[model samples]
Target: MGSGFSVLLPVYDGDSPEFLERSFDSVTVDQTRPPSEVVIVQDGPVRPELTRMLARLVDRSDVPVVLVEIPVNGGLARALDLGLERCSHEIVARQDADDISVPERFAVQVPIVEGGADVVGSAIEEFVVEGDGGLVRVPPVGHEEIERYARFRSPFNHPSVVYRRSAVRAVGGYEELPLMEDYWLFARMIHAGAWAENVVEPLVLYRVGAGAYARRGGTRLLQSEVELQRRMWRAGMTSFWSFSRNVAVRGVYRVTPEPVRRRAYRAAVRRDAEREAHTDQHTDQPGTTDAGQD
Candidate 1:
């Protein structure tokens, strides 16, 4: 039998209502082949309502939910490290407190890990919720398409990823880099010769809300990529052409205006929608496996 998986959910205080409920529901696995354990690492103090909700979740748990509370606030990397240390399983999956994974996320990802890829992930579906209660779902992406973007930007959705515990440990786990810890982790993995693959399915429902990180322009994001490039070079993991291409890509993003960047994001979503429509038309005409998730 394959190794059972453990989930490390890192939650900071203040969570959106939709986000909290969706996150909890995503991991509220059914009786069959449930997670071996779930380590909820509370990063800091939470609102009374959040506390009450967590308490209720604990009481209602048919499977074990271990809550690891920190006395004070820790940053994202530290919180993840703490939860990772607590996991007893070989497969450690990541989830944010404010996002939801599709039901078959682990079911689909686990076999890919078992099949020998150190890092296995899937496409993500992002939902931007307006303050006035409206929500928009970004269109879907395929695994290969995501990989192409991964070289320049973060193609793999961090919270929607599952990785082999050994590989994570081998690379010194996650680092406390600014802004793009997830991207840095991927760079480290690729640098260390750790193979990665993604299911062509959309396995996560990611929540996007107004936050400081989002408000900040592309400066921080671009800086992180520069640091990633340095790290990759130090690790002797760079091809000359690929490195130059990455630099050129960052140069373009750096020069683009913020409004233009936002427009580009929206355009990417529209293109994804068109691609999906095309695929659907082709699939509907013949016997095809709808191997998609949302």
Candidate 2:
């Protein structure tokens, strides 16, 4: 049977009430199949205005909203762990306070998860504060491709995902990790025999700007990349060379000039867009089923 749906949202003081309201609306009002309940985890203290906003959002929403608070700032992974345990459904759809999930996302992904898929995610359209930007797409589509992609980059977009709680719990509940908690969890799941699929379609609008670029790179992210890749190496997920190479490339990308890094990222996105367009041109051509975690 198809598992029930619940949203897992982790918020912090940094998440604005404006974004939170939009996020809540996207899941509860915009969605074709709003989650049975929305489990929001307050990672730490929030502003008084945010507190008022949350209270009002819950008061007006039809779907139940369960809010949990961490006494202190524990970060995304820990907050997610809290939300996961409180989730009343077997299928948990992840959403970020700053992202807007497409209305049909749950409708499209539910069947895939019901058909034995453990994890499912889709591409995203990135937006600035005004909601206009490029598409942010994950590179892999199936389990085989996903694992290989993992040796390099995260195989799925974290916010555009729905995962089976049992499959995730079987591997291990969310554990705090440096910058890449989602990637780490997926790697462990793949290691534990769980399967995943990427829908190859954009299902969320991700918010980002210059600040995101700055946050994504630099010395701190370099350290996290190195630490994460090394963990994969220890787990036998990658060779020493792959580990070293990933660290070097990512570190360089991080420390590179922002303009150059931006161009490179944009170029890659352009290429992906072109390739997808070309594939779509051949309407009858056989291609990946966009099915099977493989």
Candidate 3:
């Protein structure tokens, strides 16, 4: 409701305590402009270790955290829907349990979203299983490029995204799309004539591993892609050609050998030397030491 935004973070059993702390700190306390509040959704029953970690984080964090645990494992889309409904702010930022955000992530995005953008996301620094792994930067900046890029791939990083509360609600919140919930929501938002933009800089450290890749590269994904593209084509957000392109390209990636897929994945994202270089210049950068993160 105020100038500050609400961060929506959802987690499950597999998330580590290290990831939970860094992700929570990056959004709640370790930023130039911290959030007004945080709405963390427990998708379902998590491991006991994760429960203890959540308790420790909520107990230690200065920001107000509202925990909403569902009765059972409702999956990400339903969890996010509940979180979005509980948010009191007009602007909502998305934070993944295992990723880290730049200290200035909110400071940079709030102004642009306040200006006129319905959805504003930044490029991300993609790392592998280990936090210190190599980085990869994605392309397309500004609303125009984002719209263009959406035809082939997800233009904005999901964890690095912030959306106008009303804009997302008007589109019926997030849907239970197999592996493309974020991208599916983006397309629906665009089809509804929402204005979207992508900041050229990296704002979040995106974590990926075999698990993340496996989610996106299963045979089940073909059906997901088909359904998503059908919705896109029916909504007029994607053309027949674009629909075919998405299925073809994404299908190949899913069917490719694991090693080749990993290579391709690495090729799609870029090194975060830029974010690291800027860290030395900025005094307020977040120092997420590996200490106690485990």
Candidate 4:
């Protein structure tokens, strides 16, 4: 693959100007490799702020900004595929309108993309606003370990990923799976024996509820999990026993004692916070306006 790269940002109604501004801030660009293009796909009717943000970004950045507006909302996969087709570079990065990338995210990941991994993602930290001058922290985990633990849980947070345009296209880009498009893509990638690796660094600050996770109800989330199990089984990456174990663990989480469950959730969140802080030490400030390069 060549050194140049592009970013595909799929925007929707609720995306705010502040979020987009912050997203641009996190990418660390250098002269060696700068983002050649940023394709922002508006899947449906856009909010006033979102429109204003797009205008501002197109005007301010040196990189080319291509805005594609679709009359009807077809879903994320379709919007992403539309962006993918328009990309001109060899390396493509994914960003959600609401999720914020860490500074140096692309600068760090692009080199790995050349190392032959079809998909290169990283550990992630997440945050939820708390009352009165406070934010909650989420921790980072190892992807290899997470895959090993996937028999009982979903360990990879897909938003914090950067993949090769060719490898993803090889898997047919994004499929019409249940809800988690990233997970579905991962299943197919692993099944095809595509080389995918994860950097230990936490390169993205994924906003949970307001971003990707809130699009569905609880029933849909459960169904999506079940669907992933079936896909993995069919792909031969996971055995029936592993699928059953994952489902059983999720069921146990549902019926566990309140205090114990609360503690577990809190502990998990605290760990994420610690991991974010640690990764931040190696990264630049989160609010700078330098786009990433390949």
Per-residue lDDT of 29-55 in model 3, one digit per residue for the tens?
789989989999998898888999999
Order the candidates by TM-score, highest first — what do you get?
2, 3, 1, 4
Estimated TM-score for each candidate: 0.78, 0.92, 0.87, 0.77
The stretch of ten residues in a row with the least summed lDDT in candidate 4 is 130-139
Which residues of candidate 1, in runs, are more than 4 Å off?
30-33, 129-150, 210-218, 239-248, 251-256, 268-294
User: What tens-digit string does per-residue lDDT give for candidate 2 at 47-141?
Assistant: 89999988998899999999998889988888998899999989899999988988898888878888888999987888886455566664566
**Ten residues in a row with the worst lDDT in model 1?**
130-139
The TM-score between candidate 2 and the true structure equals 0.92
- Backbone collision tally, model 3: 7
Q: Over the stretch 1-294, how does candidate 1's per-residue lDDT look in tens digits?
A: 667888888877777545665687687663234577888888889888888777777788766788889889878888888888888888888888887777778778878888887887776666665223222233234444444455656656687788988898899888987767888787677666777776556677666665522443477667766777666656665666777787777656655776776676667656755666676676677777542422
Off by over 4 Å in 4: 28-33, 128-155, 208-217, 251-294
Off by over 4 Å in 2: 129-133, 275-294
Candidates' C-alpha lDDT: 0.70, 0.83, 0.81, 0.68
In model 3, what is the error at residue 92, expressed in angstroms?
0.6
lDDT of 4: 0.68
Question: For residue 126, what is the lDDT in candidate 1?
Answer: 62
Candidate 1 at 56: error in angstroms? 2.1
User: What TM-score quantifies how close candidate 3 is to the native fold?
Assistant: 0.87
